[model samples]
Target: MNEEDLSVLDTVDILDSPLDAIELSEPDSATSPPDPEEMLLLLEHPESTQRIVAARAFCELKDERAIPHLINLLQDVCPLTRVSAAYALGRNPSPVALAPLISLLQQDWNGYVRKGVVWALGNSQDTLALKPLIKALKTDISAVRLWSASSIVQIAQLEYESVVSAIPPLIEALRRDAIAPVRSNCAWAVGQLCRELPLNVVYATAIDALIEALAEDQDLGVKEDAKLALLRVGDPRGLKMIEELEQEGWI
Candidate 1:
């Protein structure tokens, strides 16, 4: 529903209306957003567009009563509807929605829908999300991987055991993913998880990966994110390496 989700125009262009039929209008100063109760009714509208609008409205309104309706829209034939429902579920983040979201993430052919589903799972913060999200980070498209990295960090908040399990894949992706945004996200995830990890082999390994990225990554954005990770963790070893690299004008 934010900048990350599909734009309002992109979602509304479901049927590919002719350009001539489109018109821009000025906002009425007194007009208000649709009533939540009315919008909820549109969740079951026969027209896919209305369903999409209603589902998207919940991303901002976030009524829990919309939960089952949003879940039902996950199976709608329209991908836009499905994806919008996915984003709405992310905003609501009802526990019951997680399983259905995971199923859609696993089987939906549309990348956008999968992306929204992963975002929703992250919001769930359930340990159940860890494995599927890790798989998505490793194997899904870059956009999904980017969000998966972020979602992994969100779930990392809940448990130490899960943090231990989550760090390795994040480190792996940090060093290997071709996409800079994904790498940057993994760097941020690694830093956040390291903040919670007790001193251990896994913590050292994550710090090492961040330092390695700072020294060797081809992209400046990835390197900056890694540098920020190192700075945030404040590990003396990482700090010393950063200082030496700065003195040598390598940072």
Candidate 2:
């Protein structure tokens, strides 16, 4: 056969070859968890995959001793290792991990890494993360902003006070974020905050912003989310607007 024809035949043979059958082993429930020294050694392994596996194992073990090691991995050469470290930190909550996670959220070059940091903050449920998450709304990256908004919502659900400082930025995000989903999520976050805050407390500006979004935002999804937010905040103007939309069949 000519070289080209032989190459094609070789390719077909490789494609048709049977895959290796991998054996799976179940963990022994009776076996003891890995000692701290063993876990630390794994975290320092030359292979990134081994380090990641160790981080996940720490998560499953919920060992607080792994917090510092995981935080160190947040700056690992591999982004995947950093992501895994963030995930492990989130799964295993520690007050000590809070500052490191926040720092990573702000400084991580990778958006996915920042995303993982956001999840870790949300999982921490520490009200201390509230302002940083609010600031995250202004992030140019949509995914980070989206998760930041979600983390805000999660934190607010636990502590109403967490949303108090978040209001102005959230309103701004709803009014002006370039991405429709970020704007939509901001509207949802604002609505959630308003619902928890006292009715007598004046969030007149926020109410007005949502009203404007409902009336004039370019995106239909933002408008709808704004309407829902306003309704959630129990704004009379929002109720009126929804009624009008329903009557006009524009809802």
Candidate 3:
């Protein structure tokens, strides 16, 4: 991962601005961070605009009280409302929202809504998120697939067994994902997961993937990320490959 602690692996960042569709308009710039109790009321307001603003408010609010309301809005007729609500649930992250979030991710037609849902599921850090996230990494649209790689890292931090489960998909994505950034994310995730694993088949497999990318990937950015992953994991095989590649003037 990067030099910033936990950010590379643990943070669920949306590179593309999915929120651009529902930017919050602060009613009053004067109030230092608005009132959640009042925002909660607005959450169910009749107007779709009101609901969008209210849902977006909870994105910064993090009040657990908004969890159920946000979950309800997951099915909103408006894609913008549903997307905002998904993001708010990500900020709040209640277990109650997990199944609903997963449901939305699987069935929602809007890519932005599904992207937000993927982010919430990742931030929730629930084991149940692992399978869906893996599916997203493998099968979703590029934007969603990008977040899925990083989110898998978020869950893998919880346990060793989870790390074991996470590595294969990550390695698979790194080796074959068509998008360069998605593959780069998989590389970063693989390196971060390696920190949790002992020297074993899983560990060796991860190192092998990184080395392969470092040597063979077409994108220079992807190659640099793979090189960084190898350096971070500090596997002998990876370190040796870097050395040989440097000696041969290939890196």
My TM-score estimates for the predictions, one after another, are 0.87, 0.76, 0.89
Question: Each candidate: what lDDT?
Answer: 0.84, 0.74, 0.86
lDDT tens digits by residue: candidate 1, 1-251: 33444333233223121211111123345877558999999999999999988987777676899999999999999988898888888878888998999999999877777878888899887889989999999988777788899899998769999999999999999999977778988999999999998899999999999999999999988989999998999999999999999999987
- The reply for model 2, stretches above 4 Å from the true place, is 1-41, 57-61, 156-161, 231-235
Question: Of 2 and 3, which scores higher on lDDT?
Answer: 3
**Which 10-residue span in candidate 3 carries the lowest summed lDDT?**
1-10
Q: What is the lDDT of residue 152 in candidate 1?
A: 92
Across 37-108, the per-residue lDDT of candidate 2 in tens digits comes to 787789889999899778756655677778888989998988777877887787787899899999988877
lDDT tens per residue, model 3, 105-153: 9998777787788888888989999999999999887778888888899
Highest-scoring model, lDDT: 3
* Candidate topping TM-score: 3
Output the better candidate (2/3) by TM-score. Answer: 3
Pairs clashing within candidate 2? none
Better of 1 and 2 by TM-score: 1
